[model samples]
Target: MKLFVYDHCPFCVRARIPFGLKDIPLDLGFQLNDDEETPIRMIGAKMLPILQDDGKYMGESLDIVHYLDALDGLPVFGGAPDPALVEWLEKWNDVINDLVIPRTPDPVYPEFATPEAIAYFTRKKTATFGDFDGLKARTPELIASLELGLEALVPLLPDAEGASINDILLFPVLRSLSVMDGIRYPAAVDAYRHRMAERSGVPLVSALRASC
Candidate 1:
């Protein structure tokens, strides 16, 4: 199996973390900012986190995670996520992708601090859920919603043990949120954030920070 990704993309980071945690042997191909053709050729879209297994290509982080989870005999939704949970997870993914990731600027790159960059991001952010301030304000609410979902998920984890999809899906968003100032979360969510920070896959986020 081979994975093609760039280090800065949160989607790619999240997709690769599960593979590493599962100890899956995979050839990694990284595309730098100037590189373009490989992604288009491999997946018919210029997207990072493209997975190729036995000549079969898959794109989109969530889809790749689901596929790999199936291959490893792990539950993609943590032992059968209910419909409501599934819906929330999907929405949660979108919220992070649209609102959080864009608002939380990369710490290492001040070039992205330009007015033009902010304008571009403002456009992308507005396309999702309207004003940036409103969307940013709702992050706590989103985290709370995730905590409610996690509360439902805690008992369903394999052996009532460690992490689940809830952790995988929410951790990166929380980490990204931490990069920003004045973002507050509930106590339970903060505790979970602490736990996720200790995971083996947590180093993968540093890979992203370096890219920035």
Candidate 2:
């Protein structure tokens, strides 16, 4: 199976996670940000982490995760999503979006490799997210707000027994925030991030964040 993705996408990370957890062999393909036709050709839309398995194509992040979960041994992400975690995401995702949207394109990712690709991404994102410059200007305030959200999150961290739908949803949000510096992760949150990264074999952007 091959997973086509944009490197900076959290949804892409979601689809990537199950493969690593299950030790499944996957052919990963990186799509340039400006390439609309490829995804359109595959899934009839310009969305990704598209999974191509045995000449068949699939779209949607959670759908791909669920499909891969059954491909090998036992399922990795099972059971219902935790309501507390789900509720927390609903409350905090807007804040997370505010912080993450502007920062993703700045990274040296294959998806944003070209000027046109970067421009395409910027236009598409800023259309929904307002403006990157404004978002960047408000980083300090955004970080402060996110810190409070993180505190609320610490108590909601699930027990480290098995992967849950909550972890699957929760980890990517945290991982997306990992792209920026100065947001202090609570010890438990930091530990959970590292564990999830290790488990999924999808690294956080902290090292990249440090350099930035």
Candidate 3:
């Protein structure tokens, strides 16, 4: 029940869904940053969204989500998911790597993008895509691709009120779009994002919070 995660990681966001919907309090407090990597290293993967349950550790986000979903006794894919969605999740990382991450701001803002986190992202991303500036310059194409990608997913999202694995999966992508400028998903996808947020029990997180 002890979950290690960075608030902004899309993977972590996906992993948080079961807890959010079931309203299970995390056994661990807000342990962030390097603190997360320590125990995860013991598991030999050194990854985020690592769940420590009864001395066992799981690394991958999907694995963590699936494990939690099973514990909650929810069907992981019973809602007649879109065929496009199935393909999309299979290629989700590729989409993030090739299109979204490059266009995203270095710090990602208001979602725990500390200096160290930003540094790590830059280093890793640069290694994957080469020349961060060049990647950023392709914002137009990348953003368009992102929109199309999500549009392809809008139909597959579950109608369950705020609590399906699909809702968890889609939330982070919508969040990433909110961070980018000059990017707008078509009306259907935009509406779908809002409804999915409502149903998943995790509302969209905004960068600027009002004092009130």
Best by lDDT: 2
The clash count for each model shown is 0, 0, 3
CA lDDT, candidate 1, residue 180: 47
Which of the numbered candidates is closest to the native, going by highest TM-score? Answer: 2
Error of 2 at 130 (Å): 0.7
- CA-only RMSD, every prediction: 5.6, 1.8, 3.8
What does candidate 1's lDDT look like per residue over 1-212, in tens digits? Answer: 88886544667757775675566776777654434577788878767789989888889987887787777686544454345645655656654554455554343433244556446545664786577677767777766665565565444322112546655565555565555444345556656655565552444334446555
Poorest 10 consecutive residues by lDDT, candidate 1: 152-161
Give the alpha carbon lDDT tens digit for every residue of 33-120 in model 3: 4344574565775567778888888878878777777775764533544566667877665656655565443433432346665566
Residue clash pairs of candidate 2: none
lDDT agreement with native, every candidate: 0.59, 0.86, 0.62
lDDT of 3 at 107: 38
Task: Sort by TM-score, best first.
Answer: 2, 3, 1
- Candidate 1: C-alpha lDDT: 0.59
